[model samples]
Target: MLEVDGLTCRFGAKTAVDNASFSVQPGCFVGVIGRSGAGKSTLLRMINRLEKPTGGRILFEGVDVTALQGRDLRRWRARSAMIFQQFNLVGRLDVLTNVLMGRLAGVPQWRSLIQLWPQDDRAIAISALEQFDMMPMAAQRADQLSGGQQQRVAIARALVQQPDIILADEPIASLDPRNTRIVMDALLRINKHFGITVICNLHSLDLARTYCDRLIGMSAGRIVFDGVPAALTDTIARELYDLEAGEVMDETPDFVTGTLAPAFGTAAVA
Candidate 1:
């Protein structure tokens, strides 16, 4: 459903993403793991066309997203939504309105300014909230909700767009452990139930291992490891994080930290 080839991005003289290449099939859950400044976030932005790549081609359903312009670019962006580390909701707006904003792509600018959404659009927004069990908070202001609630609302907003692919950059970074689990659960549910392709940049290896079907490890703006979660090893972790094997063991999950285990078995990576 999504293809990235020879993706490269530069800031001044330094490259943020160097010739990264990967493809995600429909309904797959892919995780991107690396330390700070590994260019994971940059890669996500480039996939969504928010950051123009200096070299490479990004194709969504066979359309070259990097070459898109004007309305075409806007359309592509609407088809593939991005959720940020921060919830990025309007603090003062009611939760329903925030979700309704996701329909802006289909609504006229004048109607949106006056907080007017079509009846069908309103129905879609409400249904999206219901999907995440966030309907009760629809009338409340965004700032009044907890971190988890805000993130769910953000997910609902993305769902309202009916996007084909979801790009989440550290969606659980600011939450506590319980909230992190909640957010991850919601994302997983969305991917499974809706069959939407999901690509996320995560800081927590445990979370990534537990939730992602495939993992991609990056270092110094390049992809160093790409494979199934069961194939990840202490050596690979050390290479990805630039740590010693012992240090990697300390960071790996207790069950599978020492040896490779069957997929989704008791001996799991974290």
Candidate 2:
């Protein structure tokens, strides 16, 4: 289990994440949603230790990860992988080599620095690519792939890390609708097939309801609602976005009130 106890982050007088607390069980797919500047990204960054917290602590399997430093911090990061809104692959490197970078935590520094990955690591990278139907592009430069394809390579990179948890921050915000579905489907596969815990930040309620087992709603850096998608009524959504009933996202009422989407990965992709 992962425990986020009273986690807080303040920039001068402004608190980006205000005393947030939550616990996630193993293999759960969670989506964090809120308007811009709601601290959705900040919370994920804190969980991954990409951003330091101002108060409270994060415990993974009973260890206080907030206090870890040096090699210990690096190891903790390796165990918890992060996928960004922008695909953070090396634009100059081949897809396979970018995936192999996930193994740098375990690879000898000298070998990694020299780009000399072992055969075992190379095989693992290839396997991850094959899982995403990206093996054919293994030799292609990351910059050459389309946005959806690049995100898949990014997912493959995260897979080779063999992480216990995957934290994705607005991963599909930049993709077209088709690519959005494809990326979301890939994330669902990681959570179900690999049994990896996934905490994703999303802007679309329909996508969150489709892909996540749980939804955490934030407003002004505070968690205002935490429950299953069906529990998120239109009133609660208004509070989340601080908007009138008619002013929320277009047709949000229909999606929230209508039948929830079948869990992704188990059902056929549209």
> Which has the greatest TM-score?
2
Write the residue-wise lDDT of candidate 1 on 1-270 in tens digits: 788999999999999999999888999999998888999999999988999999999998898999999888887887888999988999999999999988888888999999878888888888777766798989999999999899999988887787898899999888876677667877887777668889999876777888899999999999999999889876677777875334434544333222222222111101
- What TM-score do all the candidates reach, one by one? 0.90, 0.91
Which segments of candidate 1 are over 4 A away from where they belong?
Answer: 243-270
Those runs of model 2 whose alpha carbons end farther than 4 Å from true positions after fitting are: 244-248, 251-270
Write the residue-wise lDDT of candidate 2 on 162-195 in tens digits.
8999999999888887788778888887787768
Q: What is the lDDT of residue 229 in candidate 1?
A: 84
The 0-to-1 C-alpha lDDT of every candidate, in the order given, reads 0.84, 0.86
Give the per-residue Cα lDDT of candidate 2 at 57: 97
> Candidate 1, 60: how far from true, in Å?
1.3
The superposed Cα distance between candidate 2 and the true structure at residue 252, in angstroms, equals: 7.7
- Prediction 1 global C-alpha lDDT: 0.84
Count clashing pairs, candidate 1.
0
User: Candidate 1, after superposition: displacement of residue 69 in Å?
Assistant: 1.2
